[model samples]
Target: MSGTILEMKGICKSFPGVKALQDVDFDLRAGEVHALVGENGAGKSTLMKILSGVYRPDAGEIRLHSKVVSITSPLVAQAHGISIIHQERRLFPALSAAENVFAGRLPRTSAGLVDWERLNRQAKEYLDLLGFQPDVRTPVGELSVANQQLVEIAKALSMNPKIIIMDEPTAPLTDSETEQLFAIIRQLKARHVAVVYISHRLDELRQICDRVTILRDGRRVGHHLVAEVSNSEIVRAMVGREIVERFPKVVAPRGPLVLRVKDLSQKKRLKNISFEIHRGEVVGLAGLVGAGRTELARCLFGVDPFDQGEIEVAGEPRRIRSIQDALKAGIALAVEDRKRQGLVLSMSVRHNVTLASLEKISRLGWLRLGAEQEIVQKQVRDLAVKTPHIDQLVGNLSGGNQQKVVLAKWLAKQFDVLILDEPTIGIDVGSRVELYELINDLAKSGVGILLISSDLPEVLGMSDRILVMREGSLVADLERGEATQELIMQYATGSVDARVERCGR
Candidate 1:
């Protein structure tokens, strides 16, 4: 909102067989949270990397405070008061929160000795300012994903940066955690720090960002003030196409119950959780971070054992003590962390798509390459997964295509219940519409979907029914018509224990 502090003028970057960026110009004003948005392969990351000095631009000049500057490395960028906090948090899990924040740059006492007392005190002050009061001595590994991210922020702020680049910082956060992050960003804004926030969540940009820049296939497309552009317009700018509707939930008449859980309990994570998912129904699981949404999904998928529960598959009680047991009982989990759990990055699309259904694609002890290719090819075409070939490495595909490949695994099987955790977390607009269509088709085909997402609009848009969880308990259940964003948040934050009154209302 004030004078420009950082500017990348006509930047161009390229690699073998790929031009990551092309003549892109970006400017950041002090005290402004400017959004950088695009699809996965649109070079948003590439541009930011150049800004952070990770990669040198092929052709361009960077200006800081209207003066030309050379940033040869990340250290140089930091020296110039530039800090980047990546989506995958860079922290030492074994180290304490304070130690991680001051890992390389810890204060030294007069005699060239470590200053432990000062380190913890300084870290505590930053954490308190951000409204994040985790124990400074606690190992980062012991903290939840949300808290670890907060620690990451504290580390960035310790640099006393003038420019901060936050890449998908809130992808792993829940609603309340996101609010906490926003508060910290506001504090930075008050200090006149410029933030370059890179995310695929457009609504988030509207709320906190002052302006937005869109990139597509290595080229700058459009830049606009947040107040002037609508969400769909932003999508159009980023994707070069209109996203007519974000959610494509076609009415699928409900069928008989396919899964039923009675008194599901998992220590401090889930307490007496019970739910029913019928065939052709999409039940959305909504909650804030640490409200036990992912934990419940893990329990249901047999990734973690439940203390006490009755899991009924098609009216027959079954013991699901392992992942294989869960699969055998016609339950499959498309985990939240797609990069780590859902697919093997090193594997080809064909290999990953056929991973869970290997038995069906192979004979006794012999690999069936033909059957594998055919199945993967069909799935790719059906899901509209944009890939060079079925043999293409999944690691190279976009976020949306990667998610489709994860779904292809389940689509290969005859699973009665599918648990999709944060299915559209990092995907763009057009691909999200495609995914929503796929979800609707799956439900129409009598496949039950238990969608667990931190994206409230996505849940409200696609769910046939919404279930709210808070502090490891199911506090509210409501039909699609009765479930509003305000109502769900109230239940999620424990403002109301209206489970009896709100359930089925």
Candidate 2:
């Protein structure tokens, strides 16, 4: 659309036991949305980190406006009119939304004190522009994940940047919220701003991006106009092969009931939620952002208490008061926020994997190192997790790999039911297929799975039956053959009346 506004030449970066990027070259044109896509650990984030001054390139040259410049720190990057909205929320949880939006650049009065009125007013302007309706004075910690993501976007826009990098910006947002974000991106493009959009959702590229650059194993592999390449071609380039089936759903033989919830009520969060997952079955829980899918999962997993409910595991009633109670009852939950609720980031991969199954790998309260290694190694290898060693910190691995470790933790244990919440949010297309296959395998092994996802296609493809939720209640339960994207939306958005079949129940 315009002349090149930024160029990165021969960029190379390395970490211990990893060559994160290898002589990668990327250029961004003004007034265009350029997409950077790759499998996790393929160096998509690494290259962007280098550009945003989060990491320095071992060998590279960065030019902005045709002039070489060194971005030594985040402040330096900001000074150069470059801003980034990270995949992870990087805000002070204790601070108000307005305060976080203008954290470093708050308005000050003549007396050198913070001008609270102007600071909030300016912050509200940006949030309002993005169609974010939350109060500006609310603490970020109190907001929903989608609202927190909007705050990150608002913070970046407040900088009045010439270039902005958004990493998986819509992962936590609803379909409506994602559309709003796209509209904002369009407006920014009209103002001659360049955007570096990174996401695992391939379908989004054709919708909002102008050009795409693909990376594989830390090297630039392919670059093309979004209009010229098909999604299948892009998938092939990113993974180095063709993915025959994106959702390889296996029709495992259903067995006796493994999990059942009766009259589950969590005050205003969940209302009379009732569902059943038989052994060797994948029951998809589909809903919009605030349709209470996650809340139901949390209630089942004991992360939050349910005011009134009856949980049955293998036809035996049980009271799950805590995580330990849930696990003891042969239930496991892989939460949506892997970094926070799922895995302990500071721990080694091996430790995190074995953390959930210590009893199986220990003797007399002493860890059996050999048994631990054996289990962790198998899980890591089976998941195809890219890691130098088991001792590598889970935080050092890519987001997708980190998620694999979370699943590995549960896999190492004996569980009759597995609850996976947004399991493929940030995973690449290739990795997502692998996860689907893994889900099939798990179901084949007689573990009932409750898959909670906002991804409609995934729900429709992998599920034996789809349960639609709306306003904290179960609205519709459609068989795999009867479920469609449009029908699911109608049920989720209350466009259709509740019509649930007693299939699983």
lDDT of each: 0.83, 0.89
lDDT of 2 by residue, 279-356 (tens): 999999998887898888888888899999899999999999987778778888888877566677888999888764
Measured with C-alpha atoms, the lDDT of residue 412 in candidate 2 is 73
Best by TM-score: 2
List ranges where model 1 is wrong by over 4 Å.
343-369, 374-414, 493-497, 500-505
Estimate the TM-score for candidate 2.
0.96
Model 1 earns a TM-score of: 0.89
Please report, as a residue range, the 10-residue window in candidate 2 with the lowest summed lDDT: 357-366
Tell me how candidate 2 scores on lDDT: 0.89
lDDT of 2 at 458: 92
Instruction: Assess the local accuracy of residue 232 in candidate 1 as a C-alpha lDDT between 0 and 100.
Output: 79
Q: Which ten residues in a row have the lowest lDDT in candidate 1?
A: 358-367
Pairs clashing within candidate 2: none
